[model samples]
Target chain A: MFVDLLFNLRAQGLVVGVGEWTGFLDAVGRGLATDLDGMYHLGRALLCRSESDFDGFDLAFAKTFQGMEIADDLREKLEEWLRDAKERTEGERVPHEFESMEDLLEAFRDRLEKQKERHDGGNHWVGTGGTSPFGNSGRAANGIRVGGSAGGRSAVATAMERRWEGYRGDRTLDLRELKVVLRLLRSLAHDGPMELDLPGTIDATCHNAGDIELVEKRERRNRLKLVLLMDAGGSMAPHAERVEKLFSAASQMKDTFKSFEAYSFHNCVYQWLYKDIEQLDRVATSEILAKLTPQHRIILVGDASMAPYELFSSYSWPSTTTDAGIDWLRRIKQRSPAAIWLNPDPQRFWQHPTVSAIGRIFPMFDLSVQGLKDGIKKLRVPH
Target chain B: MAEFAQFSGTDRYIADEALMASVNAALVLERPLLVKGEPGTGKTLLAHAVAETLGRPLYSWHVKSTTKAEEGLYTYDVVQRLNDSRFGDADVSNIRNYIKYGPVGLAFDSDEPVVLLIDEVDKADIEFPNDLLRELDEMAFTVRELEETVRAKQRPLVIITSNAEKELPDAFLRRCVFHFIDFPDRERMERIVHVHLPTLGPDLMKAALDRFFAFRKVAGLRKPPSTSELVDWLTVLVASGLDPASITEGDPFLGVLFKGEADLAAAVDKRRGRKSW
Candidate 1:
């Protein structure tokens, strides 16, 4: 019965395997869940592994059990009212007529459709700022409010709210997480002071009939020099925070890298790269190119979105720079072969003219956690 | 099936319904419960609470950046044996004496069920979790040098906590029950704080919570103070004999709330009603 729910979870990009599925089924069969609420909590606890998957789990749940809760909730409320009515004394209670179950359901469905139509009409439903009877906090007699007042909406509607969307991992990089992923960009080589090799000392002692024989090995240290050229100003302003996080994380890794340098430029790299984002201090691009070697890895951060003339024209990005932006890019790439481009723009929008042009120059990835992971993997290999 | 003790939370820990369900599920399923959340959100404290409520002995293994997976199982003390033979008056004939068991091994070797807390597992290297997959799955490990396998007499309940310094492997994550403890809402936060400080005045509690939530909403805070910090700050407030109304005038004891210099500056700027930092 839950096989469709499993498929739906997979369709929503959750990593739900047979092991998790069986465990979920096991929990269910053990009588842990007796109602919709219990089952919802059980499925999430057993199947979802991270906060990122919670949003997807809620989606899959709402899809599988869409309208089931409406009837369940109505029955529960009716039963509750019936019990309340039973508690009242015979003299205090007034005689009431009830509609047939079918007619009651028919009226409920019609009212639901009318509520949705009013929602679509605007200014009369949940989406509008004005007071509407079918929405929350609206003042209308005998009007049913939806959401925010708990037990008033169906379970499916609550699940569809997707409250855990902020915790999704696909968004922009967090600061500490950025530092963690950037730690993998190191190329470790053993070249420092020796430390005692405990395992080898034990092996030598055991082989020599419990005789003491000390063994020592050199410690390993990261030996890669990293250069970060980030884009600033103009269209890059939207992505300034993300790029700054990347730059700050990389620059702060003093112990992880042999040397690290960061320079900023507007749009694309021209003849000059600024020492800071303010663009007050500038240095010729050729001087940096001359100082760099083939071994040094370069990471270029930018949105790579601009007019077509910005890359090919000499004075488009700025009137002062003499060389074309594309020429300076090729010179840097030629000088340091191990370089990659990190675009803050989503991959779907990479069809832009300038982003595509830069894509041919350097392998590009998004400026997200997963994208940075992929970029770090590519950076580790000697390109 | 054996009857397992369920954790309904202790007097100190205020776990929500979902968290309770997760702990119970993990207990019945006999899988490790991997609890993750922001720092100071009681990720590590959950293990202590579980151990106390279940009436089981607790074993803790604090992970560092250089910690290896093998250290959790058994460590061969070759140097000690060599020293005993060379300069010390001790028997070196039996290798078993030198095979000291780590936290996991100690938990497995215990006669009764125990709670093993691997605190901050993400502080170790990326491959740390994958290395223990086999031993964690089977609850057994073979001491290769001794040519003997150590199996659990009673499967110990394992609880792992991570601050998400790094992403854990998918295979390792799939074997455990995961839960993220969100920052408690205002009502829940008041209850949590009240649990820590019962004698706190209502007016002071109201003023402090208002200031705390307002400070948390200020833009560009590098690190926000959590529940534990709030409790500490309020304790200081009561001890200093400060008036509840004066709490709104300026941030007293700001150091107790904000640990980061950048966050402190931003908070101060916001309080002063500055347009820019």
Candidate 2:
């Protein structure tokens, strides 16, 4: 029968009835009775309008709630549900297997705080995976999630398998592994007979009438070279790790894939990033292709998070073949049939000052990341 | 601005000496304070919430790609200026001083202490922020056309923010103290989410909170969704017509929850079969 806190705020002409008032109130209730972060949140809800204003509210909240004692006298149940403040999660990094983005964020934030606190102390700033490398290498990083494989139900496809699974739940084989299997299956395509080499071996095995034995044989051996160029930079850091896991999965599938090398780049693909224990940085793209055969497919992964200048500017990282960054990308597009810009950043951020400019230069742009079920399904490898 | 204030909480965190000190300093120091941190970290919420406690008018200038300084200050009324210039033989001096006020100007005109919210300062082009440093630092502007100076006299509380996408020019950031907002701890978040999303059952709160912490450990996330995002996620889950177990299985939102598509994709793959991996 009583009016709620939200109603009171609405009466005061300070709260909106639409959009997100309920969510705001829920957070404030949590903050009022819980932590400074909640208090900051309450301020953002009431005061800020966009991403930047949170700073003012935060400064204000920190000042106001520094010594204030929050009233936590809830009617019994709320107390037990509150996530305790002292339970740090750096050493005992728990696994979060969420089905949706919502659960991922809530669970992820919890891990972030412990590492954030560690970072705040001026220790372990450089990422060393989920385990905090400051003093705990044998343990999991406070906020990092270089998590183990989810399960075999997870796609064995290093890259495309995830896509295939997302597209068609039929895992006749891992899509990423499928790419390798396709190459392997193609490689086994030989011109010679299974148990015979040529005329002599054929005569010895089948004893065909001399001179009357005539057989036609075509030149064969699977030849498809794939060169995957991934952007390795700040923006690509997170997605790159996941993409790497996919690569690891594909590599482990002994029966499926042939050797497909991967390379990482920044403004331009720096050097090829390989799963090989010997980390090679071969600059000769042609030599690498020649050795693997031109038929190999080139798959690139990266968030083209470069300054706008990197695209059209003449002086921006010049290659021997092109004058500008855009020209260089065009050259690569010409050299390979399957060159794409696999942006790690979201599509919305694409309009962002940097991404749009880069997108303009790279025409064959696919904004999907390597992991979404649909994204992996879209990878076209010559099987 | 009204679009947001109506839905936001006006109390929870207010009237702290630190905020007042910062706000009062913005008024007195006449400098735009730069705030940096993760998105949804409440960078935008401070001004409105503080207004309730400060008992002042809060004016917000939402920064975007086309958010020029002129847009923030005053747009030229070409026809009006032309009409006034031609009709009734208005004096040149009178016409020159006839500029109207915008959000920045509104802050200058307020009688009470005002809080100016410069949301997502990082999103704008370099020039927008560059143009404001002098106005923010000196709290004064020159009207060369009128040969006059219109000083704020009482500068408003200034709050500028960047998600740290690109480092702001040093000249722009020199105006105020800097603070990095650390995301709330698990217990803190649990308490907050529990209070905000009361509709969710206890098991949900416990399970969601525990799982959330575990996630932050792996899946190298981009801008961990702020407390606000989680609150919405939980609220939607409870109201989503799905049972608790179903809610747990249906929560993949890397698309909505983070700025990186690939990161979420990777997270999904990392989570392949394991519900809690």
Candidate 3:
């Protein structure tokens, strides 16, 4: 019976197994989960391993148990059955004194609206006289269930709410996750000025029949230099949060890189790149290109989305000469062939003219956990 | 079969209905409960609560980066025996004297059911959990030197916690019941605070919660104040005998709540209307 639920969970991208399903069944059979609400919690506890799967679990649960609400519609069905029985018993005559139940309800509501003060003995107003149809404890037949006794039985309603949507993996890149991803860029090598190699000296002395020999080797250090070129302001504003998380994660890892530098650009890199996100402090793009070596791992963070003219047009606001924004981008990529563009925008939106053009220039990946991992893998390759 | 004790919750630990159900399910299934949550959400305290509620002995194994799964089962002190034999300090004939049981080994050796807390399991190497998969699943391990298989007298109620430093292996995760402790909502938070501070006045409680929640909303806080931090802050406030009316903006106990300098600045600045609140 729960095989459909298992398939549904798998369809929603949760890695559930037959073992987990059997365990869940065993738990339910042992009376661990007594009701539908209890089953929801029990299923989540048994099936899901991380908070990232919670949203998917909720979606799958809601889909599998859609319209299985028993408590809510019970009253309506019971009333319908009662009405049918009364009609058969009365033999083709109206059960209530009014033309229909709707008319009776309408008249009751109309009286309810007009009646102001309480009347103890009257049958007109919806008061406690045992005659009015609207009030509780009344003798009137086919009265509405007043003041509520029915409670909702739908467990799927809670699942449909999707409260854990914020915890979805693709939605946000938390600081810790970003740091973990960026830690992959660390490449430790022994390349600094030579220091005394004690082990090497001992091995050499032992091999040379006890004659003392000195050996010097370069010190081991993190030799990777990181250059971050980020798109800032204007259209890139929506992505500033994700880009900031990436930037902070990279910059905070003081031991991960030999040298780290970040510069911002608006939409496209023109003749200059701003030192700060405010775009106030500017450094010439040619100077940045001249300074960067191929050994440096350049990570470009941006949505890579802009008007076609912004990349191709020669006279696009910031640049006045014949050189367009695309020329500057190509120049940077040429200087550092190790560069990769990280688009905060989803992959589906990459078909945009400017995003694709930039994507073509540099291997692009979305700014997410998996994307960062893949990007680091690309960045790790020696040029 | 002996009936396993059910865990409703302890007086100090304010577990909601969902948490209770998850705990009960894990208990009934006799599987390790894998708890993932934000820092200060009482994931580690859960094992303690269960132990206290069930009146069982608690054994904890705090995992570190260099921690090995083998060490959790048994650590044979060969060096000690060698030193003793060399110095002629004690008898060295018995090899069993050198064999010391680790936390897991001790739990397996216990006469009664115990609650074994594997705190911060993700701190170890990626292969760490996989290495102990068989031992955890079967509740048994072999001491190769002794050539004896040590099995559990009673299946220990295992609770593993992760701050999610890294992704746990799928095979290891599949054998466990998982629960992610979400940040408590307003009502739950209130109950939690009252549980921790029974004597706290309602006025002060409202004021502290208001300030604490407001401070959390300030943007760019690298490490936001969580439930434990709130409890600590409230404890400090109550200890200082500060006026409830004085617990408005720019409370002097901001240092207790915010650990980072930038977070403190952001919170204080938000109150001053320098940034969007």
Candidate 4:
């Protein structure tokens, strides 16, 4: 619905992006989000979010209103109707049709616990791990571990093995081991400062009545904020969408990070990235980029397509400026070992004179597409 | 309402059942249903059925670039509030009572289910969804000055439509059931035509549909005409007393369905050259 609302609004002229929608949802799940007006947060959320992506969103919307006279008439009609509603609500309460989000979660948890108890009472358990890619399946495997605790080395290994088994994916596994995989794949990863789940620590302290709702409803506090600077133009065009998809995937997938912010940089990063990619002021943006921390998991999106001698050739992206995007990248990676480059340009192309030239500057940049998932894997869980 | 129900029976068609189920369930669950599909797939009709079935007055909010959340909700009428404010203690309540429930408010107040149709929610800014989520989750909201929660007893069934431009974030996807409506198949399209245009002869309908599919096959159309458009155009042809002998006259009405000038020309040329499409 979020996607639906997004496109629907876009059709009408309001244009929210996937990033904003995610942030809004993150805000809602954690219960920190607020309403701006009666414009309909729920309505927008339910109908506008799309899984196939932002492609053709506007075209579809324009189709729905082909002979729509109602669009014009309804605006004023809606305002009048709203007036009538508040008028009716003057003295009494007008309870929302939907339950409290907190209440809904409570009910959902209760139903889940009931199912868990019934399942646990049976021969098999809703145990351990499984590959819960989108986390849409309620991610049900909480507590029925195969003689292990929730956090630890064994848990980690069990998770990896479970994922590995599923990775082969030819054969299906029993229920118990599947949960192990789900927890491994989707659970948030944290290592410092706001580290909610230590890399390998297990604390068996909890009240008996406590449930695993929090396990599914994650707080953004554990997220490791990343600032991605992708390179566009040139050979990067073909892989632009692919690189962005990875960025999109990582944006929603990574629990190790709080939030991910992305920017596009050409040959150098002397300044800040424009929030809107269309507008970038060299002097001011450079100053802003300088202020951003190098601690971000700065994954570069461009296919180092510059001339082989380009970096040493002495001309930066726009040239003659005091900014070196490659240098900022090297500095950022030094602070966070997780930084990696994603290029859709094939590896065979990597040895091409142009790529070879860029490679001389940044030797360890992995040049593979399938390696995208792997690179992101390294960023969050650490090799 | 009758126009559309009959229109559904026209010579042209769209296939949208999975979307129907999702929308139905969302309403049953009292959760909003978000529908994303191509431009001509009938996203708005689902909202129409909801309003028809539930007996709730339909409130349509067409999102625009400048659309602000504040505008969708209640706006203050200072004179009304101030005038009522002095009437008495009851009048104080009246000040807050300057009710003109917006679509969101109508969903909250109407004793009957109000279908709040946000026809195209994608036009707003990236912050739009976040802005709407709270009012949706709360069903009841606190207008800053009210110092109290204005809760809705009646929850409106929210129907949002979109064409997927990009993948929505997981956070946004979490709030409701999402569905994508596909274009209808040949058999269904024929059936739809029969339903909307019962008076049309079967052979003529089939011929018209054959041409419709042939036209849809040509790539590069911005958006193929919707069932409603096809039906409207066919009606125009039939009412104009167009003959199978002179199909060339239907060329002007082709604009209603095919936006591509080249495709339209090709389709027209194809029809003009043949006695039957």
Q: Which candidate number would show the highest TM-score if scored against the true structure? A: 1
Candidate 1, which segments miss by more than 4 Å at Cα?
A71-142, A146-158, A191-214, A290-294, A313-316, A319-323, A331-338, A381-383, B1-5
Lowest summed lDDT across 10 adjacent residues in model 1 chain A is found at A93-102
Looking at model 3, residue A22 earns an lDDT score of 91
DockQ-based class of model 3: acceptable
Q: Residue-wise lDDT of candidate 1 within A298-320, one digit each (tens)?
A: 99999888888888777644656
- Write the residue-wise lDDT of candidate 2 on B175-212 in tens digits: 45444444677766765665566456777777666546
Per-residue lDDT of candidate 3, residues A189-248 (tens digit) = 998889999967876764454577899999988888899999988878887888888888
Estimate the overall C-alpha local distance difference test score of candidate 1: 0.81
CAPRI docking class of candidate 2:
incorrect
Writing each residue's lDDT as its tens digit, candidate 1 over B1-277 gives 1243277788898887678778888888888999989889999889999999999999999999999999999998877887788798887889898999999999999999999999999999989999999999999999998999999999998999999888899899999988888899999998898889989999999999999999889777777889889999999999999999889887799999999988888888878988424
Of the candidates numbered 1 and 4, which has the greater TM-score value?
1
Model 2 quality (TM-score):
0.41
Writing each residue's lDDT as its tens digit, candidate 2 over A206-287 gives: 3331223445465444343345566654566667554564455444543333455565555653223333323344354444
Give the per-residue lDDT digits (tens) of candidate 4, residues B1-277: 1111211211233434334445444654555677876676678876776566555689888888677776576655544454444553545444366545566765676677677887777667545766778888668766664566667777777777765432234455566656666567788777777767878876567657766777676543545676777777778767877665444335546776666676576666665574222
Report the Cα lDDT for residue A304, model 2: 63
Chain A superposition TM-score, candidate 3:
0.64
Q: Model 3 misses residue A278 by how many Å?
A: 5.7
- Cα error of candidate 2 at position A249, Å: 25
Query: Model 4, which residues run further than 4 Å from truth?
Result: A1-383, B1-17, B54-57, B79-94, B97-99, B165-170, B248-252, B260-277
Better of 3 and 4 by DockQ: 3
TM-score of chain A of each: 0.77, 0.38, 0.64, 0.39
